[model samples]
Structure formats: C-alpha cells, structure tokens
Target: MVTTAAQIGWAESAALIFRPRVGELLTNTVLLVAITVPLCAVIGVGGAWLVERTSLAGAGAWGAVLAMPLAIPAFVNSYAWVSAVPSLAGLGSGVLLATLSYFPLVYLPVRAALARLDPALEQAAASLGRGPVRVFFGTVLPQLRLALLGGALLVGLHLLSEYGAFALIRFDTFTTAIMDQYRSTFNGSAGSMLSGVLMLLCFALLLLESRARGRARYARIGSGTAAPPRRIRLRGWQLPAQVGLLALGIAALGVPAVVIGGWLAYGGGTVWMAPDLVPTLLQTLGLALGGGLVTVIAAFPLSWLAVRHPGPFSRLLERTNYITSSMPGIVLALALVTVSLFFVPALYQTTALLLLAYALLFLPRALVPLQAGIAQAPQSLEEAAQALGRRPLRAFFGVTLRLVAPATAAALAMVFLAVAGELTATLLLSPIGVQTLATRFWSLSSEIDFAGAAPYATLLILLSAPMTYLLFRQSTVLSRADASAGPAPATSAPTTAETA
Candidate 1:
C-alpha cells in the first residue's frame, strides 16, 4: 500500500497529468461522475418519496420495478441504446447509459431511509404551513441527508470506475484510457505511469466519498423500524405524477428492449448465440461464480471482526476494505498487474490473478449486505448459545449464521453480477485470447460493430436482471425485517465483525 501510494506521488505521475490524452480522460471521468450522481439521487429520492409519502397504488411494485435497472450493466444498457437508436450516439448516450445502470445506488439507501423515516418531523413541517416541497426539502431531506449522500457517493464512485458501458458508447474516460494504455503498450513505462495517475484520481475520489461517511450515515439501511410516513396526497397532480413515471420508465427501459429485439429478429439465430459464445460463456460464468464465492469468503472474516470485536483496529480494517473497494477497478487491475510482473512473475496471465482482481474490486458489494445480515442477528442470542457450552464457531453457525443465510445468497448474486458485467480489469488483465461477455462486447464495439455486439450486450443485461432482483429483494427484506427492530441499541451499535 505504501509503495503504491508513493508511486502516485512520483514525478512520473506529474507527466501523466500533463499528457493531452490524460486530460481528456480525466475530464470525461469527472463528467461521468458529475452527471450520474445527481441523476441517481433524483431517481432514488423521487421514488422513495413516492413510495413513502404519496398515494401511488401498488407502490411496493413500483419500488421493485424502479430498481430493476440495477440488473442491466451499463455497457449492456449503452449497447441497447446505441444499437437501437444509432442516433443518440455520444455524450448523451454515455449519460443515459450510466444513469439507467446506476440509479439504484441512490434507490437502495433512500428507500431504506424513507421506509424508516419518522413521520412526525414531516408532519411538523407541514403543520407549520410549509408547502410539500418545502417540507420535503427542509425537514425530511435533512434527516435523509446521509442516506442520500451515501447513495450518491456510491453512484459517483462507481461512475469513476466505469468501463464496459462507456467504452461501448465510444466515450473515453480514465478507465477507458487506462485500458488503452495497457492494451496498446503493456510494458511501456508510459502505460504504467498513466496507471499511476489513474490510481491518484481514484484515490481522490475515495477521499471525497469518505467525507460522506459520518456526516451522512444517520441510520443503517434495511434496519430499524419507524412508523410508516403519512401520505402526501398529490391531490391536484396525481395524473401528472403517473404520466411522468410512465414516461421516465419507458425512456429508461424501452430503447434497450427494442434494440435487442430487432437484432434478435434480424440475426435469424438465438439472441444468445455467437460462434465464440460457449467458451466466453463458460469463462464468464466460471469467473463470476469463482469471484463471487471468493469475495464472500474473504469478507466473512472482516464482517465477523467488525460486527463482533468493536475495536479501533477492526474498525480501521473494515474501513480500509471499503476504501480499497471504492478505488476504481482499473486502478486495482493495474495495481495487481504491476505487482504480478515485478513481484509475482509466475502468476501473470493466469486465471488466479483475474479472480483475485475481481475479489478486490467487488469486495465491498459483498461485505455491506453480509454485514447487515450479521448485524440483524441479535448479539444476545449468540452469547446465550455460547454460555450453554457451544463453541463460538458452532454458536455463530447454529444461531446467527442461519438467519444471515439469505444475505449470503444476496451478496453472492450481487458480486457475481458485478463480476459478470465488469469490463476494465478483465480487459486489462485477463489471459491473452480470453473472452467474456464483457470483452466480447468490448471487442466488437471497439471495431464499431454494434450489430455483432448486440447479442452479448443483450445477454449481459438479461444476466444482470436476476442479480438485481435479488439485491432489491434482499435489501427490502433487510429493511422490512429490521424496521420492526429499530436501531441497534446505541451501546451495541458499534459491534465489530469479529463478535458474530
């Protein structure tokens, strides 16, 4: 870690920043993040408010439907758009793809927070003669600040690291540029130097995301029970609200459907087939399954330590894991590649290295939900089992682990989906001649072959749907389950991962 950080501060990093391509890359990266964050927040917060404070029928259904986009990888989403419309093919395409794929970052937390928000505060705001907007922006929004910020932080950070989708859209962001440097000039000192600069940019984003931590996280997601918020009848505007939602959902979801449909029709084959499909499919599945399992396994110790130990060291370790996960995957792939060539030469070009990179990059997505699961297990129950002569491990498994089982499935689904859709690290570090759905789509799109890319692109989105469903379901389960429980007792709230 020390050496990696130092490399970013080295003179080579200065040269990296001054290069013209580097500037364009950095600008595009910033634009992607800047554009996506607010868009995600709007979608999440709007949906949350609708479900929690409006009279929309079947709101629970809407919540699930709205979050469905999380299933579609941005690259898949981008292809659907560009392939279908061909006209929406530039900056606007990048923004749309990013927003559609990532809005759930905001949706998950804000939904949880809204479900648990205290109705009295908003009632009090309106009782004081504030308009609905005023009440929401003032009293309600302040209380939801952490959730909103945290969700936006995730969206922003994810955007910074995004690769597959942006590349397909013909955009050049930092992750794209870094991949180019590697593929075009793998051993060139210039490529490594550019990667070093990317690491710096990723580090800065990590720092900015950290600022949203204590300043935001007012309550744990999917945990705690507060009274259902009173409805804010959109008395005069109900029709408009429904119309707007329909339009938004259509725009977000429809283009991809049409594009994939047309391509499937025109090709006279399985929407799923490519001549190289089977090998790539097996490789993609193998890596996604392996990485998901590995990440979950790695997170177990950290989650246990953080939830059970309750110490500064454990806390620091957990935070470090998140920080590392927040760093762009491109940076991680580069860091691992750099390590392989210099320190672990035998591992280069091997499957083991690629899996390790996946584990490092998506570790937090695995950790957060798993930690929430562990936390939902009451500490007292574990203590009681331990006191009855059960071994600690036995007690945890016999008691807490059984309850947290659903969460494990959810975590695995999320990590697996993320790994499946990932493009940058896989592009940079996979064995030569390797192909996954991601690289398959990437190669075709790179050659401006949108028609050829369509099948892989379509499948990636279809593949993501199940994972996204599981994520929303698990998040909802955690929220509804815990909403009855309220916050962990203040004294026990700091439980470390070790104790469980």
Candidate 2:
C-alpha cells in the first residue's frame, strides 16, 4: 500500500498529506488510539483482576460475561447503541463502543496470565510486610507485563483498523477516510495515501509496544510448583464491585440484547422470513470455518520456524506477518483487488481470494496461540517417535501435534470468531452473490433498517457465542497447565503473544 501510494507524483502526495482533511483524520485517529488503548487496558486489567484474584460472587460467571462483548462485533454494538441513543456520535461514542467491544482482547490474555503466574512471588512479598495494593503493584503487575501489553496492542490495532464501527457513528478516522476515498474513486491515490499513513501508524504502534516490552525476562527458573493464588476479599467493597460489574455488563451486553430484541419484537416473524437469512447464515459458517482452518495451517510454518530455529530471520518473518495483519481490512482488500486485476484476473472476486484475504488479515490471531502451543510441546517426544522407526512427519503428527491440540483449538476458535464477525474485507472480497451474516447485517444496517438488521445481528452473536466459550475454556485449561508446570525457562524464547 505504501509503495502504491508513493507512486503518485511527489507534489500530489505532499499536497494530499498537508491537506486540512488529512490533518483532521490524523488528529482523530491519533486521539482515538491515545484515549482508547489506555481505557481498555484499565478496564480489562481491572475486570480480570476482579474475576481472577478477588472473592467476588460468581467469579466464573463474571469471567464469561466479561468476554461476551467479543461475541458481538463492534459494528453491531454500534448499531445497538445508535438504536438506543440516536444522538450518540463522535469520539466519546467511538471510545465507548471500542472499549466495550475490545476490552476482552486484554481481559482474556491477562486473566490467563493471572492464572498462570507463580503465587510464590506474592507470598514472598507479603512475607516482607508488603500491603495488598503495594504487593500487586510491585509484584503482580510487573509479572502481568506480557499479557497486558499483548492485549493493549490488540486493542490499538483494532482501533486503527476498525471501519464500520466508527463509520456508523460518523467518526472520521483514516480508515473511514480511506473507505470514503475508495468509494469515490477506485484505486485512487488519495485512498492509497491514507492507507500508507495508516500503515505507518500501525508500525509506530508496533515499535512502541516493542520498546515497552523491553528485554527484561519474567520467567521463573525454580523447580517448585506454584501454589494457588489467594483471593483478595472485597469485604465492604463487595457491593461496589458487583455494582460496577453489573454496570459494565449492562453497557457491553445488555444494551445490544435489548436493542436487538426490541427490533426483533417490532419486526415480528417477518424478520425471520427474509428469504436470504438462512442461506446467509450458512454461508457465514462455511466461510468462517474455511478461513479459520486455512489461517491455522498458514500460521503453522511460521510458528514452527520461530520455535524450532529462533533467529533474527525467524523473528523478522514473524514480525512481517504482524505488519500485514495490522493493516485495515479495506487497505488489504484494495491491495488484493489491484494484484488480482493485474496479475491473476482468474482469481479475482473468487472465494479463494476472499479466504486469502482472511488469512492475511487475521494471521496474528492464529500465530499467538500456535506459537505458545508449539513451544510447550516436547520436541524430545517427537524425536523419541522418530527413533521408534516412525518417519519425521508421522512423528510430528503423532506426538507434537497431539500435544498442541488445545492451543490449536484455541487458535481456531479465535480466528473463526474474528472471520465470522469481520466486515470490511468480506465486504470487498466476497465472491459474487456471497452474503455472509456480516455483509448482510452491514447492508441492512447501512440502509438504516434496524429491524431488518436485527436478525442478522442476533445470529452473529448466537453463532459466535459457542466459539467464545471454547476460546475461554482453552485459555483457562492451558493457563492451568502452564502454572502446574511452573514458569518457562528464563532462556526460553518468547512467543508472538509475549512480543505483542
């Protein structure tokens, strides 16, 4: 995209960059990220700490509630909010919707980290007379560095790449501007310039996160088992914690449910009778499943190379995937459109191209868990199988692959939910006549037909709910396993998630 944008005459590029419109978008995009990422980190870290470290009532159920926002796409959340409050718009609404929808990106990982942390450190700190708050700040928070940073990075990327959510609210960021530019003129220099700028922003975020992560190692080198972490009693604060969680749940999940239900009630059986609805649901399922499996397969080589042969080259290759993954779906779709039209016209507008786009845009989601899974699998087990007269391929499939099944399932669930809710790329690259739930919901919602859009939104959440549960289950199970195994070696290489 940067190359394509740079092809424009220098005078035009400079003029485009300096235009007032560009300045407005740059301001909006920067401010949005600056505000949203920190807010999400706070909410996510706070929520996870409450659920995982407190004696709050129904902690397990609240953990699921915290992740439920992810089952509803940000765009659908926007539709729900707009339906509830027609006047809601601009940066405040953008931050609210993005925070509600993406905080789980932080919560899930940090919750998992909290589960996996060695409680011995906290005990040691307590033995030194440290108070709870001070112990958390000094011991717990630093140990959570990798997970918190990973989640925050994901939130920032989502902020930069998101389009439909901000678009519906009339918030003009670079993504929205790029979409507008593309709609006005296909393959226009203006849109490419915006995309180039967006890519630069994404890279800057990557670099910032990288530096923040630093070279400090958090791994334990001891052979002792981790004791269960002691839960902090809320005591008089219990009521307030519950009230706060209730408020959050209402904002994140209740609003969407009420709005969609109201529309469904208003539309009656007629909404379900929409002739395209069932087919669209099936199409969405097929595409999501296919894209998720393909992304996992594509991620395998990169994960394997990074884990088995750590080097500068491997690290570079892994980071390159993140660079592409961070691009706005529209930017990626446009690039694919250009490449297909010029070099592979036969593949243009086909399911193959659409699936390819999905793999490119969401590779990082699959990479994180897969790398962690691969790193945990015992290479010695695979070698033992090879020595038992099995071929290398057979050994891997029988041993290492089996060991990483949970992680692979976690990766698949994450990507599947992402693809199922994806908007911009599906909008641009779906095969002719393909109408997945996202595209269908987007079309109806874009037309301001809230009642007509309700069923699709309902189906989107229902379809994603199971995968969300599976993702949470897998993460919890893996975290427990890691805890039981004690911390990773201090010399061990970091996974993609840690680097994020």
Candidate 3:
C-alpha cells in the first residue's frame, strides 16, 4: 500500500485524502464498525451465555443455530435481505447484515470459551456470598476476556474490510470506495491512497486489541482436572431467553434460507442447469482447498515459533501477520498485482499468484488456532519422543503434530471457508476466465439476476456449512479436553503416545 501510494506526488496524495468523498467514506466505515461490532459482541456474548452457561431449552440445538449465520457469508446475507426488501440499502442495512453475519464470529468462540470454563471458579464465587449476576460479572466475564477481545477484533476488521455486503446495499466504506477508485483513477493512485488510510485503521484495531489483551495469561497453571461448568437455571427467564434466541435465529439464518429457496423455486430446473454452475463450483472448491492447504502450511511454522520460541521478535512477527491479514483484500490484491506485473511477469494472473494472495490474506485465520493448539501440546511429549531416539523434526511431526490435529483441521476449515466466500481479492487476482462462486454470485447479483445468483449463493453457503460445524465442534471438543484433562503424571511413567 505504501509503495503504491509512493507512485503519486505528495500533492496528488493530499488531494485524494483531503477530498469530501474520503470523509464520507471514513465516517461510514467508522459508524459501521461502531454500530455493528458492539451489536455483534452483545449478541455473540449474550447468546453464547444463554446457550452454554444457562439452562436454555435445547441448548445443544441452540448452539448450532447461533453458529448458523457463519454458514452464510455477509454478502449472501445482504443479497437475501435486498431480495426480501428492495428498499434495504444504506448504513442501517449494512449494520443489520454485518451484525447478523459476524455475530457468529463472536458467538462461536465465546460459546466455546463458556463451554470450557471451570465450574469451580463460579462455585467458589457463589460460596463467597456473591449473587449469581455478581458471580458472573466478576468471575466468568473476566475469564472470558481473551475470547471476547479476539472475537471483537475479528468483527471490527471484518466490518472494515468487507466489500460486497456494503456494495450490495449501496453503502460506501473504505473498501468499496477503494474498489471504485481503483477502477477509475489513473494508476490507482486514489485507490492506493484510500488503502493507506484503511491500513492505518487496521493498525489501530491491531494496537487496540493488543492493549486490551494486556500481558495477562488466562491459562490454568496447576495439574488438576477442571470440573465441568454447571448450567445456571434460567427459571423465569427461560421463555424470554427462548424468544430472544428464536428472533436472532430467524433474523440471521432464516432470511437467507427463505430468500434463496424462493429464488430457486422461481428459477426452477433451468437455473440449476446453467452451464457455468458445475465449473464454477469445481473451481471454487479447488481454490478453497488449495488455498486452505497453503495457508495452513504457511501458518504452521509461525505458530510453532510463537509457541515454542517465545520472544519479542516472535511476537512482532505474529503481529505482522495479523496486520497483513487485516488489510482490505483489495489492498493485498493490488499489491500482488503490482509486484507480479513488475517483478515476476510470468506469475501475473496465475493460480499460484492467487493462492499466494489467499495465504497472505488469511494467514491469521490459520495462525490463531494453530498457535492455540500448539501451545496446548506439551513440549515434554516431543522431548520424550526425542529421548526415544527420534529426531527433533520427527518428534514434532510424530508427537506434537498429532496432538494438535484437531486444531490443524479447524484452522484448515477456517481458511477454506474464508477462501470459498472471498470476493474482492478473488475478483482481482483470479486468472482470466476463472470465476469462483463468490465472483459469479457478485456478477449475477450486480446485474439484478437474483435467480441466477441464487445457485451460486446457495453453493457458497453449503460449502461453508460443514466447515462452520467443524469449527464449532472442534473448538468445543478441544477446549473441554484442555479443561478436563489433568496434566501428565509427574513420574517416570511414559505418556500414552510414548506407550503406544
């Protein structure tokens, strides 16, 4: 982004930044984030609390339903809303679409955190004469700091960088403005200027998340099994809880299903038989799988370095990846376009280049889970393997890697889902004549051919659904295992892997 901006003279850059359009976009983006992120956090945290910590009816079913929004991309959600209500266009619509789509980003993680919280802490607080609300506010909420902070950070970044959802609603954000500017401006100077401002916003988010995270450690240090959290009895609140959850589910998940199904029925078999459908689906899956694999491979070493070799340098490198991933996809796409065109002409507009962009854009998605998973894999286990005549490399792959398999799978699923629904980057970097599900959906939807877009949108949702389930399942299972599993016996006894 800086390099791109440097191409223009200072006066041109100033003219770009000082314009009225930039201010409007800046205000819209800031207001969108301010409105959507808090709503998402509230819905996410509250829904997670009700389902996981309270005796909400059908808690298990509710868990899945709360996470269902994640299966629908924000753009698809926006498409559904626009179809349902033709007048839905503006900041209000943007906030509604974004909150519904992104609250799950908060809900899933917070729910998983709630599932793994130690009941003993709450019990202790209650025993000290704290009321239920007091116990929750003082004990449980504090324990959830990391999950809440991470979820909010993700929500904020998504709101900042999201393109299609806002674009569909005629709501201008930095991303949408950047795309427009790139298309019209000479050498993309104006677009690059907008991207620079957007990057600064991303950096601000990163810095805020860092400060909120502080230097506090949330890990349990002792060697004892944690008791499962006891569900709080809702009592008089059960009906209200059920009502709130039902409304949320209907808003977030029901809208898309109904709209898409209506469109499918309207279009009938002919739409399904579109010549591009199969090829587009295949290409979407192929890219998603390839990008997921590449991103996971790229994240593994960084995760390992962060987990096994903790230092200021490692932390800086970790933050650097987050900063990269937080930028609007258009920024990364344009940067890659510039680099490939000037330095590696052969790589221009190729699958490899696109995959590289994906890796760069979604590395943090892959890195976060890998770091958590690797951190949980005891270093002693690998050392024990080394003692058993295995090489260090072999020990890590054979011992530590196996332990973090679930997390690795979760990471892969995350990146896969992200790549499957990616819009701006894919639109720019995908090879000529290549159309993934996202690009196809955007094209048809933009042309007001909702019926033709429905299939693509449906396919995108289907592609993400199982991955969403996997993410929810893996997070809960891993967090519970970490909470319940006692530390290795401090004896000469070999571990299970060693014994096996």
Please tell me which predicted candidate would have the highest TM-score against the true structure. 2
lDDT of 1 by residue, 164-241 (tens): 777766788777776777777674455556666666766675566555444333444444336766787887778877
lDDT tens readout by residue for model 2, 1-500:
55655577788888888899988999999999999999999999999999988899999999999988888889999999999998988999999999999999999999999998888888899999999999899999998888888889989988998998999999999988888887777756777778778888988988788778777777778865667889989999999999999999999999999999999999999999999998998899899999999999999999999999999998998888888887789888888887898789999999999999999989989998999899999899999999999999999999999999998988988888889899988887888899899999989999999999999999889988887787788778989898887775676435444555
Consecutive 10-residue window with the lowest summed lDDT within model 3: 491-500
Model 3 per-residue lDDT at 162: 91
- lDDT (C-alpha, whole model) for all candidates: 0.76, 0.89, 0.86
List the RMSD of every prediction in angstroms.
4.2, 2.7, 5.3
Judging by lDDT, tell me the better candidate of 1 and 2: 2
TM-score of 3: 0.88
Q: Residue-wise lDDT of candidate 3 within 1-500, one digit each (tens)?
A: 56655777787789989999989988998999889888988999999898878888999899889887888988999999999999988889899999999998888878877877767778989999998899989999987777887888889988888999989899999998878776666366777788889888988887787777666655555664476677889999999999988998988988899999999999999999999999999998899999999999999999999889989998888877766777789989888887888789999989999999999999988987898899999999999999999999999889999999999998998898899899999988899999999999999999999999999998898888897887688777877786677444334322111111
What 10-residue stretch in candidate 2 is worst by lDDT? 491-500
